[model samples]
Target: MDGGLMLAESLPRTSSFATDRQRGGAAFVERWTNARAGVIGFLTGRGYSSCSIAERIDDRPETVRRMWTLWDLSAYGHDGRAPQVVVPLSQRDRAHLAGAAATAGLTIEAYCEQILVNSIRR
Candidate 1:
């Protein structure tokens, strides 16, 4: 045990262990860390697949799946969320949508949905 402890202590620690204050940017980290669960819940409630959530959050699907498992979100469909509508777009339009989504901190699917909904209002 002592030898194992000594070997572990000898290894270098990563910045991941750094505190929010130590990172000199607590706002982003704190906000996301606190809200991630709620965000995932919202997406799950909306019946979004893990892959879709991963695409929106710019994370790997496996990571999202692991999170879902850890969070005990298995109550949802095992096959994942149902498929959403698909809108064909040109390369230029796709780029524009991507930029808009990034600026709005939303995924392309979400941004497009919001746009479609707003258009219905008009």
Candidate 2:
């Protein structure tokens, strides 16, 4: 583990498997780190479960779920949280989200649902 997070330096950097990242900036590094975390988690001991996918990708169960859809993993459904705080996004962000979900082979909703369920058992 690198700095309390898993490393996925070996994952593909090619055009086909590339994720949505900034040209070069702090945000780029942050997103790159998150992607690596998710990849490492999945390749190591997490698989599609919460700690690996969710923990690695978004650092939050809800956010990870959202990532699943962004990468196209499939939706895992909602966690039924109260107050339903809404996070706003622009058109480009939504496209990026969809790309991420597609890459993960999950949908935003189902991916999150799956993470919550797996986390419960861990």
Candidate 3:
């Protein structure tokens, strides 16, 4: 999905994470860090080297390599069970939501996932 559309779909759910500053500490950072590492690992497992993954994600080679070392291979076992959802939005609305997501310190995809998770809990 496009970044703008992802952001637009997540804007309404940003509030859930935004208000929970305490939960955004070490654990939150670690979660995202591990998740990134997991992605690098996944790509490498499929034969994409750290350099290639870095280039694809616009990250530094050294960073990607480091993440690769940190990736827990066991994490991939849960990948198939993760939920998937799609939300469509107009260009203008997507732009607005992307801006909002940036302000909330989240990538559009993360913001949307958080929102969906929050909605499910309610």
Give the number of the best model, judged by lDDT: 1
Per-candidate local distance difference test: 0.61, 0.48, 0.55
lDDT digits (tens) for residues 1-118 of candidate 3? 3642323223221112222333555565222344455555555654455556666545777876565455543365323224235466789988988998899999887888788789
lDDT at residue 73 of model 3 (Cα atoms): 36
TM-score for candidate 2, residues paired by index: 0.27
Q: What lDDT score goes with residue 55 in model 2?
A: 41
Clashing pairs in 1: none
TM-score of 1: 0.38
Q: Distance (Å) between predicted and true CA of 49, model 3?
A: 28
Model 3 CA deviation exceeding 4 Å by range: 1-78
Candidates in order: C-alpha RMSD to true structure: 17.1, 16.1, 17.3
Per-residue lDDT of model 2, residues 4-119, tens digit only:
44344433333212464665665543354554545633543323444444443445555655655566543333332221223346789767877877788998645555656699
Q: Provide the lowest-lDDT 10-residue window in model 2.
A: 77-86
Estimate TM-scores for all models.
Answer: 0.38, 0.27, 0.34
How far in Å is the alpha carbon of 50 misplaced in model 2? 2.4
